[model samples]
Each structure stands twice: as C-alpha cells, then as structure tokens.
Target: MFTKKILIDLDGVLNEYGKDKFNENYIPEIKIGAYEFIEKLSKQAELYLFTSRNLMLATKWLINNNLDKFFKDVTNTKLSSYLYIDDRCICFKGDYCNLFDEIEEFKPWYRK
Candidate 1:
C-alpha cells in the first residue's frame, strides 16, 4: 500500500498530444522523458492514469509504451488523490481575483 496517491493525466502529460486532432481511438507516442518520469514517480507514490479518453484505449497505450506497470489503474473519474499532475491545470491560490484572467489567458505548455 502506498502512502500517497497521485493522479497523472495521459494526453499532454504523457504523450505528444497537441500536434494532432483529437481522436478517441488513438493515442500518440509517449513524450520524451515520460517513461523515465513515470518509472521514478511510481517509486514515490501510487500513480493512476487519469484521462477523459476511453479507459481501454488508454490502458492499451500504456501497455504499448510499457508504462502500465507504473500505474495502479486508468480512471476517468477524479479519485481522491494527494496531487494531480496535468498539463492543463491552473493552480488555485485561494484567490478568485486573478482566476478569471488566468483562465482567459491560460494555455497548455505545448500550445505556448
């Protein structure tokens, strides 16, 4: 049993996602450093693959990339986790003042 649970996003976080149009049935190749990153992170916490895509497809992608061993499971729902690692998230600093602007200006790292 792991002490911490981390939710990791699949698309932009693990794979080269922004270059191609969205396709539910397809997952792009793993991103550079992704395998090593996951391998390292898995040692620290219970990692779960979090995605809106089909779980079966995501699992297949993980298997093809030989990354399935690092993850506990693939889930679409936001489970209870210590942290969420995603390319499209904006950290909330307990202030709503700048949130709207941040949302308006926000772009994933790949797009920027």
Candidate 2:
C-alpha cells in the first residue's frame, strides 16, 4: 500500500560501519537515530534493507535490534525503488565535470 519504495543500505547508513572488516556473522550496532529514522520513513514508504552481507544475517540483525518490522525485505541486489539511500554514493548532478575530484575527495560520513 506504500506509494514509494526506498532502498536503504544496512551498514554505513543504518549501523555503525567505520571499519572495513567484512564478516558474514557479524554486524555492528545500529546507528544513533536509525531506529527513529526508519520508523518515521516506514510510514511514508516501503523500505528494503540493501546490503552485501548475507540476507539472513542482515534480517537477524534487524530482528535483534527490533527493527525488522520496519523493513519489507533484505536484499543484496539493487531492486527497483524510488530512492537508494546509501552512504557510499555520490549524487550525479548530470555533469561529468567535478566527478573525479568528488570521487577522490569523498569520504563516508563516518570517516569525517
């Protein structure tokens, strides 16, 4: 019944992800404000947790954090959605200019 589908990244976006360590069995604690943010967003759109980690692991993380109810699914693939909320992305402004500089200068919020 949602009018929009939002794909939200699990690590840096929703959880503490300052480290590059990759483990299928481990996911960090939920980021501050993430629970409230997701709760609020869920009222406006359907949310999907997008991650490179195992879907079952991600789902379990959500459940552990009591956040599973806000998401429609956990997916590794980028599904069709109204917006993709990722911390590792740069919004393209329809110009190739400054793209390289932006890429080189880019740092996820956690890094800054």
Candidate 3:
C-alpha cells in the first residue's frame, strides 16, 4: 500500500457524539457506518485517529468497536497528511472574505 497519511478525528468524527464536549473517561457512541468507513479508507491511506482525549481511552474504544486494526495510530498531534477528515471543519477555498461568516455559522454535524 502507498503511504497516504490521513488523520481523522475521533469524538465527533468516527464516534457518535452528543452536545457534551470531549472529555476523559467518557466514550461517546460509535457513529453509524464508522467501522465500514474506516475499513474502506484503510485500503487507500494510513489512518491515524486524531483526538484531544487520552490515547488509552481512545484505544479501548477503538478496540471495542473493532476499529483498531484500521488505524495505524491514535494521535493528538497533526502529522503530515494528504487529507484530514474531521467533523469540526469548514472548507476554505481561498475565500478569505467569507471566513468570518463561515466561522460564525459553523456548527459541527453532531451539534445539529
């Protein structure tokens, strides 16, 4: 397999998230299609679950969900990657003028 690094967020991305913010010892539910999504992506890229939470907790969750095999690592740092699949992000196509509006209107899918 080619080296295509893809960093994915955990709490609100792979896992089903609620309004509660990311915290330790509180593992959110696994989002629907998460394992399938990971399975497909694993074929095309080196996936690293990027989260702000503790690695041990995340690891346990991943293992329970049968997702640990698909990911190369769980990271807090953003390493070099071809793409970042995150739930909390706004695509900026170089339109700097509309950035403020986008930010203000930005609500993660989990929030909605």
Score every model by TM-score: 0.96, 0.93, 0.91
Tens-digit lDDT track of model 1 for 22-87: 887899999999999999999999999999999999999999999999999999999999999999
State the number of backbone clashes in model 3.
1
Alpha-carbon deviation at 70 in model 1, angstroms: 0.8
Lowest summed-lDDT stretch of 10 residues in model 3? 15-24
Candidate ranking (lDDT, best to worst): 1, 2, 3
TM for candidate 3 is 0.91
**lDDT: which candidate is best?**
1
Question: Model 3, which residues run further than 4 Å from truth?
Answer: 19-23
Better of 1 and 2 by TM-score: 1
Q: Please give the distance, in angstroms, between residue 111's alpha carbon in candidate 1 and its true position after superposition.
A: 0.8
lDDT of 2 by residue, 17-64 (tens): 877685668898899999999999999999999999988889999999
Ten consecutive residues with minimal summed lDDT in candidate 2? 16-25
Off by over 4 Å in 2: 19-22
